[model samples]
Target: ETVIYRIYYYINRSGTGHLTLRELKRGNLIDAMLHCDEEEDINKVLRYFSYEHFYVIYCKFWELDTDHDFLIDKENLIRYGNHALTYRIVDRIFSQVPRKFTSKVEGNMGYEDFVYFILAEEDKSSEPSLEYWFKCIDLDGNGVLTRNEMQFFYEEQLHRMECMAQEPVLFEDILCQMIDMIKPQLVKTDYFTCLTIEISCLQDESYIMLRDLKGSKLSGSVFNILFNLNKFMAFETRDPFLIRQERENPTLTEWDRFAHREYIRLSMEDDVEDASNGSAEVWDESLEAPF
Candidate 1:
């Protein structure tokens, strides 16, 4: 079933204020859980969903809302349902454990325990992948990365070409510089990808352009904050005139402005013309610009 139906209908209809085994059963958790023929597959799905819930909450806190309203959003509701469904499946699989297998039995575990278990599992799985990168950077087949090796690599490859470009000596300064470089790159890449996708779908080009202009203005506002970090963050200080100029001035040239003004003047020459074109979209203000 689609996430929308699961969130909007099944879970909501279950009327459970919080997720429980009973609620999970009523939510039709079995259908949502992916088919797993092995014990490892069951564990993987359980850990994956638990991690997903934690990550979703983390992202919502960091990027969307700190007050927890993100939990109420439709997207988050779907995510919560998915995780809850996975948890139910894992619980069911554990329920099948024989009474004789006392050592393998997991006692009544709450959501928090499940979350922590997922995190531990992820940390264990990540170690082997990092080992490969460690080996590649070890250079002399040394078992570990050394200070001298790291310094040599940094100076030879990572150093700036400009002699005036000094390395950031402080950890906080280095972190801030890294954020400055990374944030804009992420934004630009996202913006370009979104534009490409929208264009590919044959969306209205003019509307897309307007949306892009709005996004550019928002980005400029964000840039102003980074540029003037020492100043107080204020919403009302943005220059409206500069924003308007940026939006409209790109398409206007001296000749176009002149001709546009003439066309508007001709259209509004008399009351008869204005009455006849009452429903028409007017472009008088755009035409009257001084260029």
Candidate 2:
């Protein structure tokens, strides 16, 4: 029944409280089904219909839901993406700042919630993804990300870097880079003074509004630098091969790339475990043969 309801909910995208034939056709689901037999890769289809994508998402949730209760708590979510997220961001997520949880378990995330969280995390460049993180960073829910709010999130990242013995980047330096990257319309002045002099002492009342990020492609990188250390480092020391992949397949989305990578990783882990079990069987058989 839950599965049927989920299908109905996704199919009714118009949110007019009713499902229409036009909306169903707009999904292009029939076209996809007509071509499914011709394609070898299941993930090539859109996420809504892709079993491989669902497999990857479900496996990730299963790994995090260690108790097998089919619900994720703050600790479980904290372990997500190799702990790429900070506590503050996780708190914002639980607070339902971005979106309310469909799960009524109180402070826990269900599979549906996990689905939304994973999609937003993997594809920060998308409009919905942008909105999700934007709201998370907007502490006061004022629709703009103030300097203080951004700093609130980044302070944890700075402390994390220090704890790991990595060179800590000052918030002032990051603020300058962010301003330059997004190029938010601050009073036109020599912002480069931040580079030549101590920017910490200077008062630059710059705020990053949602429109600024919506106009820039580097918005995802900005969010990563603020909260997700793994992605930030990956962006800093970006792999040439991954860059080539992106260049080669411009049609594939960030979420698509992430799901593909995770699917291969999960499959490889399963194969390794099977191989280990096979080896154990061989050793046991040899012992029985007195060799």
Candidate 3:
């Protein structure tokens, strides 16, 4: 038995009476039905009424068991068509939903998931830089961050170093500044204790002596220097002496007390200014304060 299915589409335009699919295809439709003031106006109407509607009808026909209506089960046709139509309507509605609302829905997930995902994908071959540390700290795969994991890692590393050595060297203020520069999102949390420990471990000579410290401690200001200098040096292309000289010049304008302290202040500032306002230029160590 061959089933012949007739698919009908109807379009309602304001100027003319209702237009049927047959009338449209045959060019027998009234002048008012064909009359569109602009090409865009006609295209929009055709897209929604003819093209999209035809696609929906075709999908429904494809899902049917037979082509002949007489041989087809009436109840099954109604059920399948109605189900597909319902889903299509739902997709259209969701597509139109505002982005702000969608983001709010997605934002409820745990931050740990976000950080972990990022860490898992990180490239190990690249230099073990701050970005590498960042990938590790992001325990969850999500791009947005939370402070607990990062602070815990930093604190644990600091504690390990402190346990090896008896005294502190890194200044609390300098540690806070480093946190601000390295992980701004994590800096917002009340986990400054770990940051303080990291700075102390880095600065204290006695602590380094306890572990048989092998690396230079005073290469750069605490705020500007990376904790893993060895990793940075591995990939750096510049001359080692030039880099060392830059760090050695205590009188350099950028290393000045105000430069270092001001950098810290800018990172901690709650009300962020626009980029156009220009960040305080890197500090000059040589500029003497009037005081």
- Considering every candidate listed, which one attains the maximal lDDT? 2
| Model 3 Cα shift for residue 106 (angstroms) | 34
As a TM-score, model 2 comes out at 0.79
The residue ranges of model 2 lying beyond 4 angstroms of the native Cα positions read 1-41, 185-205, 278-291
Candidate 2 C-alpha lDDT tens digits along 190-266: 24632432243134556886778988988999999999998887887888989999999998889789988998999
Error of 1 at 80 (Å): 31
Candidate 2, residue 208: how far the Cα is off, in Å: 1.2
TM-score of each: 0.18, 0.79, 0.21
- In Å, residue 22's CA in model 2 sits off its true spot by 9.4
Candidate with the larger lDDT of 1 and 2: 2
Q: Residue 141, candidate 2: how far off, in angstroms?
A: 0.8
Which sections of candidate 3 miss by over 4 Å?
1-132, 169-175, 180-242, 245-291
Model 1 alpha-carbon drift over 4 Å, by segment: 1-125, 156-167, 170-291
Clash numbers, per candidate: 0, 0, 30
Comparing 2 and 3 on TM-score, the stronger one: 2
- Cα error, residue 82 of model 1, in Å, equals 31
Q: Is candidate 2 or candidate 3 better by lDDT?
A: 2
Q: After superposition, how far is residue 268 of candidate 3 from its true place, in Å?
A: 47
